[model samples]
Target: MLRGAWLGLLLTLMATPAVATSMNAFRERAVTDPHGLIDAVRQQLDQAGIELPPARERELLWGMGTAAINSNDDAALAEATLRLDGLATVANDPVAAAAAGFLRARHDIANGVGDGLGEALKAADKVLGESDPEIVAWARFQLCDAYALDEKPAKALPLCRQAVTAYRALNDDYGIGDAENDVGIALATMDRVDDAAATYERSRQYFARAKAEQLVVMVGDNLAQMYLKQGRAREALALSRASLKQELATGRISDALNSSADIARAEAALGRHREAYEQMRKVVAQARTAGINGQLVDMLKVESRLAEQAGDLRQALADEREAARLGSAVDTPALRAIEVELEQRYAAREKELRISELEHANELKDLQLKAAEADAARRREQQQRQRLVNTTIALLAAALLLIVGLLALLLRAQRRHAAELQAQTLRDPLTGMANRRAFQQRATELLGSPREANAAPHVLLLIDIDHFKCINDSIGHLQGDRVLRLLTDYLRTAVYDCCFVARIGGEEFAVLCPQAGLAAGMRLAETLRAGVAALVLPQDLPVARLTISIGVAQFDGTRCHDLSSWMRAADLALYSAKSGGRDRVEASKLAG
Candidate 1:
């Protein structure tokens, strides 16, 4: 067997160089090392004025987002998904937009973001209405996935049926197989076990015929899980081992660990306490390495059963305690019941397994024969598997070589563009300070905090460069901009640490202060006035060593919440300051 495997590997190595790779190869490599591939593709897309298809891009983006989550980055997957969704507005292609929406929904489901489902469902509906049958099937699959995540299995099941029907219409065997697996999962959730088993069998058959090893493994695992639910631990174990063989061949370590747990269940059912205990320990070790707490608890329960069967009461108690510690409050009823039944079986199945094993040997042999045929089919597909591996490695090599230059150029351009965009969004182009929109947003967020209500209430100070347009008429608008920038610099320099400052429309400036009352706000405003008066400019233009009239209001006792009211009150105080003569601070008391 080992010599044959080596010969097969040699043949695969020799055949790999002859295969043709597509853009999708690069896309998958981009997932593992995205900076290079994503940036290169982005540059190409920008130059061609073409966009990456929305669905694929969204999937890639979500993958990146998930990686960030896995790495414990401060920003969540929902935050990244939101940014990707915003990009869809300019994406240009309807199919791409639909795909993006689908990805957003998936990411949301993973991150427990409920808001993504409605838009994903709508996008799927839109795509299905306009696209080819295969595309429609895929879209409907995405929709079903969304519904399943949203806990709307009724909606999910019928849509999964629609996906399978669509795929069948397209004569797409792989699509049908995938849809069948989904259908089985949905049916099982809805208490239709017999139908689920039929669906899973059909799925496995179709996946096998299509040479879809991944789907075969997935569906096999699903069927094994279903068997576990039905209290057929022996069957579940057999199926799980078959799935593990495939997962192991494909290098899916975590999936293999899951299958090992299922095999442990079967060992326990067969009264092989020693083997079950060993398998359960391996499952826990693998799960710990993978950082998957979810399956660790189940593995512990199995260990508890093994210990109980061996009359190791202390070991059984320790295992039970560990299982309880790792278990979640949200475990499914089926899962909980399985644990109970396994415990009961451990107590009751001591004598019956020997007789049952003898009677079931022929059936097990037939199942093994079927599995051997499936394994032979896998061996026959070795050529295509080699092609996939070669394509993946070559794409990675090409991407690594191209990425540095592409990222450098793209990042340089993006930073320049971002500066311009930021100015437009948050600054007065002439005055170079935060604009009205920025002022209002920061003020609301800063003052709305309940913690700030007890700390000194935030102060809002509004300042107008008095008679600024008259200065603009005397000096050019260019000089007017200089005057504004100079005054902005002075105010920002004077109280930059304590204040959030913005240029609010033409010649108007605002400051937000946390931990500041009306008196403190007035003092800060007067300091701003003094700094502006002491300023100098090189223009030799007739602009003021510009002085500002200040109006200040502390946030206290106002039913009319939000920044607009704060601005209005501050404006009124500014007018009062100007009426009293410019270049001084006027403070307004909060209204009762």
Candidate 2:
């Protein structure tokens, strides 16, 4: 890890100045649409000579860091920020320092480190004053964000307002829309609800005009949260459902999770308690899987409240215990306050119980002074003891039942883990599709079967993304991953029930068709090509305009050979298609 870090630092130092320029270019593209800006800068970086000058190389790295930050990937953001920091320290360029400082600041913000805040704001201020209108706008917006996170919303809100003004002056609709959202966030923090709502509404309109569905979903969620806080649960529910539907329709998993949480909150408010509890449970489950301790804590709060309201005391206690466990992880002030409150409540209850016990003892002594009353008390005590014994037995039985249930759950969970591990071994993480090993193994087994020579042949088409590495390097790996996932979904639905698809390499995918001829395979390839070409990516990606190249080949009958030969032919055809301007399919000749 140390070696890798040092190497990353060296690389960053060498590329700092160039990365600054690239970041500036990225800012310009962002004025049209920050998300789209990633692709635009990527295209520019691609068009530039592959061998970049030191300055350009640094700029490209900065651009990649920016894209990673936008994608909300903290680990990637931290690595990129560290690299940028190393570059800034060695590079004399002021612009390089400014860009690097901004990235470092964002990383610090995410990690809860305050030291980077002042430096970031200072660098952003300098950049805003010295740069062109677009760069100034971008820097100012980021500066506001840093300030807000640093607990200096007083400074942040005005900067965000300024960014909005600048974008409006420039007549940049997309920039204005993004800035409007920022402004609304700042205003909301200041408790300027009316102004914030209006600002968000304006932002929503601009997003609509830009046809930016992702932006729409974001702003809608914010507005819904505001409504929920203001006791407008009905409005919140409507907005949340609408936003969730939009996110789900667009296949935005991360955004969908956010909307799902909002929907759960709204459901709780609407008195659909059972549904709300289930939804919150799912959110908690997902949060645990994702390793987001903070979200897990919040989800536990939801569960605790739901259980309390539903009169499930044991479940409520369990929820609170989970919350405490996750709370101890991050050590936030929110958790501390909750811990104190619970302790105080417990103390108060203990005192009340002590007083009640004393009063009951006094009443028992007074009753024993009267013989008739004492006789009745003796009979009642005997009856009570008998009932207690029966209750104890029942409780023991229930405990045994619970133990059995817990064991069953544990066994099921173990089995599930094993299945998941096995599946992961045979699947690609990026695309959630089959892996090369699985594909080859299946093909080998089929080939070894006792089928006749004239049995139906399986066609294999190797699909490669043209210039995939360039895409990843330029736009950031997150976007590249998104593209891969999008392609996988398209492949899954491209044909009928006769196809098997897998991502066999980083950018190489394969489709296997059972019982299909060369002619039929070629047609499938054409259909896939056309279908993928027509498919739109969820967010604004510049490369959505590009296309996939496919190489087609088929398994031979009476040959128990490895599948590599067919794979190689398909790869060659794919290469030919890419070499011939991409966006098309190529077929291999019959086996020699």
Candidate 3:
């Protein structure tokens, strides 16, 4: 029964009008009416009666695949790519095979397949040396996108430029738009913000002119994000809202959800926290229903921050914990390993390509050398020998120089990696502040030096979040982590640059204020306490008002001889404050 059904379908396709239509007809319609072309090809693939040559059939399928990709029809694209691959195999056409592979790889990448980038890169590399200018341009554009996905913007930028130049030469406005968008992304990643914005604007204009509404919306979203990063919340909000409306009208539910999230972020940035929180709630619910865990996690994080801003601490804590759980589930070691493997494969393929080019150059050199030897044969043997000797010396010198340059680059990369690791070690991962070791080391350095006669005494403030353990127990460790991070933000803003703030223990932070007196320390501690106490949650929540207890101690050489002794005095005062009442400050009285 299955065999009969398959035979019937094959007969139906063979009898279609597409088989009778010329490839030029499809190609002409591809630019102005890609959707119509895709629909026509799809219908043709469903009917029967005509007999076309294998090459013609392959061309039809290729046209359909390209049209489907342009129209963003995944089902049609998949069908066309599958058929084109089979036909290309039967006809032994490498170019057609490469084209089919690239389409399939791009589709897979869009759907989040692990090896898609590697496959795309491989396919694009295959067609890059093709004689067809359009094919070469398309291959370069695909390469740029692949590199951008791999987070190598510097590598992607030049490829994007090349693609854009090729498209301009072909007068392919749609292709130019696509390449320009990629160029913008590469520029943005490299932190060339102004250049990126201008490129995106150009892309949008090209897309608009090409009547690619979907791509225009995509560019709008990119521009919105850039505006948000630049603190232009009003403009970001406007653009995101417009994009969201367009996405919804076009029935792009996933894109609409992303746009909504952007809108919420813009709202939050503009101080419309309640509106942002409510908006994100809807986005999170929709993302969860769609089972997009990666997007859901991101949306949940935005929602959590919005909740926090709106004084809904309970909701904020719940959202944070949920986001963390989802993130952990989505971010698996196996997934990371696959990503790394893809990157390694890409690097290996690039190395292979480079090696092939070098080998080809050497082959050409060998041919030239043979010609030279032939010419030298007509001359003196001694002159030939001297020429060969000079050539050998120059080649050896070039090889040595290349090797030295590579070694220098490797050494520099290793040094940069080591420096990053060192910085991470001295920083608290959760709070992004100095750790206990760093804090103690810095304090010791300050105390060991002799004080100037007119220099103000250094003061230390030891602060602990009130009922932080209870917060962890009630909300979970994930929320506790969020609280710590939020508190760190507050502390950073509250203290001056002259003060060194560090998270020394769980729920405990120390501030070492240089050139501060006992009175100044007490005043700063009171300000911190009041600031924390002002962090009130929603009235209906079970959580109490947030608060912190502080202990202030001024450096006294007569009473506290060393850094350890001075810290002990602060600890004593901290204990006194905790004993007196939480959310209060106490100063140490050192004996003169």
Best by lDDT: 3
lDDT of each: 0.61, 0.64, 0.70
Expressed as tens digits, the lDDT of each residue in 1-592 for candidate 3 is 0001101011111112433532223433443355677777667666632555665666567677655644456777788878777766777766667667666654444333445556666666555456666556656776777656444688888788877776665556666777787777788788787887888889889878867665676668777877887889899889888877765654444556778998989988988888989998999898777554545666788888899999999999999999788656534677657656755775676677667865786577557555654544444344445665876655655555565556556656865787789788789988789999899989999888777666668899999988899999998888778778878888998886568999999999999987677887889899988987886554544566788899888887868778888888998989889999888899986622
Separate clash counts for every candidate: 1, 6, 5
Q: Compared with the true structure, what per-residue lDDT tens digits does model 1 show for residues 1-592?
A: 0001101001111111222311012312322232343445344445644355554454444444433322223244355456466656666545546655655544443333235455565565445444354455556676665555445568677777777666555555666676677677677778777788788889889868866555566567668777776788778887888877865654444456667877777777777878888777777777676554544565677778887887787988998897776543334466446535543553354345446664586467557555655554554455346775876656554554355446556655865797689778977667667888788778777756665224556678888998798888986788788777777777766774656888877888888886666777777888878877777766576654667899888766463266667667788889989999888888864421
Q: Could you arrange the candidates by lDDT from highest to lowest?
A: 3, 2, 1
Q: Answer with 2 or 3, whichever has the higher lDDT.
A: 3
Q: What are the RMSD figures for all models against the true structure?
A: 30.3, 31.6, 22.8
Candidate whose TM-score is highest: 3
Model 2 TM-score, 2 decimals: 0.44
Candidate 1: residue 265 Cα off by (Å): 1.3
- Candidate 3 Cα deviation (angstroms), residue 462: 66
lDDT digits (tens) for residues 1-592 of candidate 2? 0001111111121111333453343432222233453555456657875565656655665765665544445554465556556656666555666777777765554433334455565565444334466566666666666655444557667676776666654555656676677666667777777777787788889767766555665677768877877889998788778876765554333445667788888888889888887887787677566554434565677778877776777888998998787555545576446535643554465466658865696566445335444454555455556764877655655555565556556656865787799888998877778898888877777666675455456788889877788889988998888888888888887764546787788888888876566788899999988988888666677575547899987777423145767777777778788889998899876432
CA deviation > 4 Å runs, candidate 2: 1-50, 53-59, 70-75, 86-91, 107-119, 122-129, 149-152, 230-235, 245-254, 293-304, 312-592
- TM-score-best of 1 and 3: 3
Q: Which stretches of candidate 3 lie over 4 Å from their true place?
A: 1-38, 48-78, 99-113, 150-152, 208-217, 288-300, 311-592
